[model samples]
Target chain A: MAEGTTDVPIAGYSAPRPRAHGSALHRMARRRSTTALLMCVPLFALLAGFVVYPFFYSIYLSTLNRDMTRFIGLFNYQYLLSSNTFHLVIFQSCLFAITAVFLKALIGFILAHVMHNITGPDQKLWRGVLLLPWVIPPALSTLGWWWMIEGSYSAVNWLLQQVGIHPIAFLSSTAWARFWIIMVNVWFGTPFFMIMYLATLKSVPDQLYEAAAIDGATGWQKIRFISFPMLKNIISITTLFSLIVTFANFDIVQILTAGAPANTTHVFATYAFQVGINSGNIPMGSAVSLFMFPILAVFAIFILRGVTRRTREAI
Target chain B: MSSATLAAGAAAPRRGRRPSIARERRWALWTSYIALAIFAVGFLIPPYFELVTSLKTSQEIGAGTDPWFTQHLFFGNYTSIIHNPQFQIFFLNSVKLTIVVVCVTMVISVLAAYALARMRFFGSQMFATGVFLTYLVPESLLFIPLFKELANLHLINNTWALAFVWPTLSVPFCTWILIGYFGSIPKELDEAAMIDGASHLQMLWKIFIPVAMPGIIAATIFAFTVCWGDFLYPLAFLFTSKQMVLTAGIVSTLIHGDVLDWGHIMAANILASAPPILIYAFLMDYYIAGLTAGATKG
Candidate 1:
C-alpha cells in the first residue's frame, strides 16, 4: 500500500538508458557488474579466510616436524605412512564411515518408504517424531547414550541382566568398541537419510504406480523398475554426502570413548585431535587430518556432479 | 495397453480407481503405519531414557533403579542446573554467539545469493559454484590450521572467537540454499523492479526478500542449529570452564574427573539440546523444506 506501484513511477523511469537496458540485458535486468561483485565481497573474503587460506596453511603445517623450528618436508607424511597407529586410524576411519553410512542408508530408505506409504494427517506427526534423533545435537545425545551404555552402572547392562543375558562391555572390547562407535553414528545420522529419501519419494509421480497396478505388475516389480531408478541418484548423492560427514565425525568418539581401549576406535577427527591438540603435536595432527582431504575431495566431486545433474533434470 | 507403453504409466488414473489397486494401497498404508510405529519406538529410546533419568534423583539413577521408568519424579535436577551459575554463563554465551553468527551468516548469504542468482557479474558464476563446493569442505580438516590462526590473533580460549569461526560452517550452505530460492523467482519481477527505477538493494529488500521469506527462515534455522550445536570450535578455541558454550562446556566441565553425576549430566543434556529440538518441532516444514531445497534445487 505504501509503495503505490503504478501511481508513483519509480525514480529512474525518466533516465535514458533504454539502449543499454536492451531486452537481452533486461532478462533479469542486469545490474552493473560492479554492484553484484561488491555484494559478493563478504562471501569471497570468508571463503579465503576460512577455507582456502587455512587449507594451504594446514598443508604447510603438515610439512614441519614436532617442533616449529625446522621443516621436515614430507617426513611427517612418510612417518604417518609407516606408523602402526596411523595405519589403524586410516583403516578405522574408512571402516567406520562406510559401515555407518551403509546402515544409515538402508534404514533410512526403509523408513522413508514406510513414511511414503502412510497417507494422512498423521504422516507429518510421525515424521516430526521420527526425526527427533537428528534434531538433537549429537554431542548431547552422545552423552545420553554414553550414560546408557558405558560403565558398571549402565542402565542398558542392568536391563540386559534383567532379561537373564550377560552384559556386554561395549567400549572395553575391541570389536564392540568399533560396533558402538558406528552404531552411535548411524543413530545420529539415519534420520537425515530418511528425510532426504522421503523427499525423493514424494517427488515421484503417483500415477505411475496406479498405471503399474492396472497392468497387474506386482509391488516388487514396480519398485524394481520405477522406485529404484528414481531413488538411485538421490541415494548415491545422500550416501556420498553422508560418507564425507561420517568420515570426519569427531564428537561421538571423542566424548564416548576418547578412542579408548588403546586407540582402537579412533576416526580421523578424534585421532587428529588426540595427536594435534591433546598431545600438542601440531605437525603430526595436521598430517593426520590432511589424510582425509583427498578421499573427501573424491566424494565431494561426485556429490556436486549429482546435485548439478539433478538441478538440470528438474529444470 | 496404453499407446506410450511403460513411459505413459504416469497417465492419469482413469475414472474410478481399480478396487484391487485401492485395496493394495490401503494395505500398504496400514503396514507402513505399523512399521513406522515400531521405528518411532526405537528412535525415541535414548531421549526417553535421558528424560527419565533427568526426572529421577541422583541416587535413583544407578544400576539398581529401573532405567526405563521414573517412579518418583524429581524436579531438583532442573532446579540444580538452573541454580548453577556456570551453566547459566554457558547457556547465555551460546545464545549470544548463535544470534550473532546467524545474523552475520544470513547477511552474507542473502546478499551473496541475491547477487549470484540475479545480478550477473564477473566471476559470479564461479562464486555460485564455489558456494556448493565449499559445503564439501569438512570442518575437521580446517580446524587445526584455524586453531593456529586464532591463537596467533590471541583469539583462542575465548567464547567470542567462535562467533567468527562458526560462520565458516554455515555460510556456504546457507548461501547455496538461498541461491536456489532466489533462482526460482521469476526473472520478470527483477526486470519490472529495475524498469521502475528500484536499485538492487531496494529490489532485494522490497521484492525478493518477501517472496523468499521461507528460504530465509530455513537458512536462519540451519545457521542457528549449526552454531548452537558445534562442538569442535568451542572445544578447541575455548578451554576454560567459564569461557565455554553449552555443548563443549557440558562435556568438558560437567563430566570432570572419575565420578559421574548421571542425573545432573542427563538433566544438563536435555537442557542443552532443548533449543534445537524446539526449533525442529515448530518449524519442521521449513527445516525439511530447506533440506529438500538444498538437495534438489541448490
Candidate 2:
C-alpha cells in the first residue's frame, strides 16, 4: 500500500531525472493515478449527488418555509422546539430507540448463548428458522404483524380470549400500540444481533472455556470474565449501530401504527414523514428528520473511532 | 482438572449415583432447547399466521374464524392478488428497480472498493471512511431532500428514479464490505500482476475480481436485498400505482382506510417477501459471512 502511493510521484517525476531514464515510468505513474481517479469517479459522483448533496440540501430545506419558496432562518427549528407534538416525537423517538435497542441486545445475547450451547445440525436448522423475520422485508413482515395484531381480529387477542381472557386491543390503544411497535422492532432486529453475537461467540477459543472450567468457573463466570470482555467492542459497536438504525426506523412504526391512537406513538422518522410528506410540509419534515443527524453524528464518530482503534490494534 | 477428576469419581458409582454434574449439564442443555423452542415459535407466529390466513376464505376471515387454522382453504386470494393489474405493475416496477439498482451499486462499489483497497490514492483513507459514513446516513435523513431533487429532475413517480437514488444507500455498504474482502486478498498477487505489466484496470478485472468472487457475490446479495426491501424512498418519491415498489405498493393499494382485504394483503406481503427470504435460504452462509465481516471487521 505504501509502495503504491510512493511509486506514483516517483514515476510521474522520473522524467525530470537523468536523461537515460525513459518516459515509460512517468506514463505508468500517470496512468495509475488516472485509473484510480477513474475508478472512484462513479462512487464519488453518486455519493455527492445523492448522499452528500441531499444532506446539505436537507439542512437548507429545513431553513425554508412550508412551501419552501423563502428562507425562514431557524424558524423551523424554533417552531419544532415549541411544538408539543414534536416534543412527543422527540421523547418517543428516544424512548423507542433506547428500549428497543436494550431489548434487542439482551434478547439477542441470550439467543446467541442458546445457539452457542446447542451443538449439531440442529443449531444450523434452528438458526435458519430464527432468522426468517430479519430476512424478510420489514414492511412485509410488519404487514404480517399488522394482521396478527389488528384491532378486531388480533390472533394474539384471540388466543388470549380462548383461555377466558378478554381480547386486548393491540393497535387501538396508545399503550398497546407502543408496546407492539417496540415488540415488532425487537422481533425484526434481534436476529441480526443474534447472528452477530453468535459469530463473535464462535471466535472465543474453546480452550479458554475449558481453562475456566478447570478453575471451577461456572457458566456465568465464564461469560462475565471471558465472554463479556471478548465481546465488549463488538457489543458496543453493534449496539450503537443498532441504536442509530432503531432511532431512524420508519417501516415498522409506519406500517404497524401509522402514529395511531392520537399520534402518541410517532417516532422521528414516521412523524417527519407524516408532517413533511403526508401533510405536504416538506421543510418541517426535513427539519424533523434532520434532528437525527446530530445524535447519529455523535454515535458515528464514536463508532468510527472504535473501528479505527480496532484496526490499529489488529495491525 | 480437579473438576474433571471429581466428575469422573462421581460417575464411577453408577448403581444409584447419576453424576449431579452430568445432570446439571443436561438441565442446561434442555433449558437452552426449551427457551429456543419458545422463542422460535413466537418469532414464527406472524408469518405463519399470514400464510394460514392467506389461505382462508374471505367469509372465514371475516367471520372471525379460527386464527390458527383455516377450515376451508381458499386459493383465490393468491390468484386474485397475482392477477391484479395494479399489483402486476408494482411487481414489475419492483423487479426493474431492484435489478437496475443492484447492477449500478455493484459496478460502482466494486471499482471504488478496488481502488481504495489496492491503489492508495492521496485521500483514500478519508474516502473509504466517507463511504462508510454514507452508509450510516439513513434514508429518513436524505429522503426529504431527495424527494425535492427527484422532483427537480422530473423523475418523481418514475420507477427509473430509484435506479439513481438506491445506489446512494447500496454503494456505501457494498463498497465497505468489498473493501474488507479485497483487503484480505494476498497483496502479492496484485503486485505480481503489476510487475508483469498489467494495467491497474487489468489487474482489477483479471486478478482481483475472480479471487474476490465470494465478497462480490455477498455484496451483490446485500445490494439486491436492500434495494428490493426499501420502503421509505418508494413511499416518499413514487406516488403512482405504476411506479411504486412492492413494499409501498402493497401497503398503499391493499389496505384502504376502513376496508382491508386481509387475505389479499397477506398474499401480497408473502409475495413481496418471497425474493429476499428465498435468497436468504439459499445463501445463508454467504449472507452471514458478509454481515459478520462488515460488523466484526469494523
Candidate 3:
C-alpha cells in the first residue's frame, strides 16, 4: 500500500472494483465514451419511468372516453374545440399571458434602469426588497391577494371608496377579476426580467456609454443606441420564456379565483384541473391540458437551440 | 460600487456653471424616478394590502377600518392555524414531499447531467435537449396522464405520489442545470482519478460530487422550491385531506366548497409558504443561477 493509502477502499465493499472483477462495468467505467452512457442510466430510467411514460400515457388517455374504456379518437379534441367553455378559457389564457408578459417586461426594464442609475449604498437591499413577490411562493402571495380583494373587506375597494370612487368587484366581477390577475402576474414575474436585464447590463462595456456621452448623446439617445441594443437578446429570451410560463399558469389563477365568477377566468390549465381532476372526467381534462403543449414546444425549441448556439459561440 | 464612482465622476467636474446637458440629464433622471416609483407602487400595493388584511381580525377586517391604515395587528391567526392538526399535516406533507423529491431529483439529475456534460456518446446532445423541452411542456399537459398512471399504480392520493410524479417536471430542469454546471467543471479532475484506477462510479461519488457541490446545492434548491410550491400536481393526485401538500391542501380543503374560511385559509397560506420564502431569502444567488441555468442551457 502507498503512503496515505489503505487496502480499505473509500466506497468499501460496495462492490468489487470493476477492474478486479474484469466485468462489463470495468469496460464501461474505464472508457470515457462508455462512462457517459452508463452514468445516464439512472437519469434516463427516471425520465422513461416518469416523464415520457406519463406524457405518452396522457396522449393515449385523451383519445379514449372517460374511465379508460373505449377508444374515441378525435372526439375529446373536437369536443374541446367546439365547446363554449373551452373557447372562453382559451381566450382568457391568451389575454392573461399577453397582458402579464408585456407589463412585466415594461415594468422590469424601467426598474432595472432606475436601479442602475441610482447612486445608493444599499442598492442590493432595494433589489432584494423589490424581489420579495418572486421569492415568496405564488400560492401564499396570491392567496393574500385573494384576501385583500375580498368583496366586502377589500382594502383596495375601501381605498377607492375613501377617494369617492365606486368600489369595484375585484374578484367578483369578470372585468375587474381579469385585471387583478394580470396585475398580480406582473408583480410576480417582473423580477425575472429585472434580474436578466441587470445581469446583461453589467456586461455592457462602459466605454460604449462614455463614447456616446462624449458625442453629445442625450439620455434617450444613449439608451436607444447603446443600452437597448445590447440588451435585445436577453430581452427576447426572457420574454419568450415568460410567455410560455404565463400562458400555462395554473397557480395564480387557481389560487386567486379558481376560475370563478362563473368560470370567466378559466385558463386552459385551471380548466383542465377543474374539469378533469376536480370533476373527475380525466380524458376531457387531459385533452384540455394538451392544448398548451404544442405552442409551448415551439418556444422550447427556440430556447434549446438558442442555448446551444450561445454555448458553441462561447466555446 | 458603481454609484460611488458615478457620484465622484460628477463631483470631479468644474464646480460652477453646470452644463445644459447635465441639467437635461437631471430632468431625465427625476422623470425616470417618478415613473419607477409609480410602477413600483403598482407592483408593491396588492401584496402589502394582503399582509394588512391577514393581520386584521374578520370583524376589524370587515369593519372597514380604513384598508390602508394599520389597525389592531392580529398575530393570533398565525398561532391559531399553527395549532390546527389539518394545517400541521399539510405542512409536514409538503416538507416531506419536498425533501424526498429534492433528493431523488438531485440523484437522477446529477447522474444524467454528468452523462450529458462529460460523455460524447451518440445522441447525448439530442437527448439532453429533449429532456429540457420535455420539462417545458407544462405540468398541466402531463398531470392528467400522470394521475391516471399513478392511479393504476395505486399511488393516487398518496403524498408519496409527489415522490413519484414531481421528478417529471423537476428532473428535466434539474438535469438541464446540472449539465450546464457540470459542463463548466474541468475534465482533468475526473481523468486524473480514472487514471489512478478509480471506477467512474467512484470518481463520481468521491470526486465529482464534492467538486460539483455548489451545482448540486443549486439543483437541490431548485428541486425543493419547485416541489414545495407546486399546487397543480398535488391537486391532481392527492385525494384525502391528510395527504394533501400545502399548496393543494390550502387551496382545496381549507377553502372548502362554497364557504371560504378566510382566517384558516390565510394562516395556512402564510405557514405553508414559510419554507420557500426563507430559502429564497438566504439562497437567492443559487436560486437565480438555477433558474437561468435551465433557461440558458435548455
Chain B TM, every candidate: 0.92, 0.92, 0.85
Find the candidate with the highest TM-score and give its number: 2
lDDT of 3 by residue, B227-256 (tens): 888878887788798899888788778777
Give the alpha carbon lDDT tens digit for every residue of A151-242 in model 2.
75578888888898887777879888999999999999999999999999998898998777656577799889998999888899899999
* DockQ for all candidate structures vs. native: 0.51, 0.64, 0.41
Candidate 1 regions with alpha-carbon error over 4 angstroms: A1-31, B1-19, B257-259
Q: lDDT tens string, model 1, B26-96?
A: 88888988899998998899999999999988777654777889888998989998888989999999999
Query: Which one wins by DockQ: 2 or 3?
Result: 2
Q: For residues A143-229, could you state the per-residue lDDT of candidate 1 as single tens digits? A: 889988987558889888999888888889879889888988888899999999999899899998877777778878988888889
| Chain A TM-score of each candidate structure, as shown | 0.90, 0.93, 0.88
Worst 10 residues of 3 chain A by lDDT: A1-10
Q: Clashing residue pairs in candidate 2, if any?
A: none
Under the 3 Å rule for N, CA and C atoms, how many clashes does model 1 have?
0
lDDT-better candidate, 2 vs 3: 2
Model 3 clashing residue pairs (backbone)? none
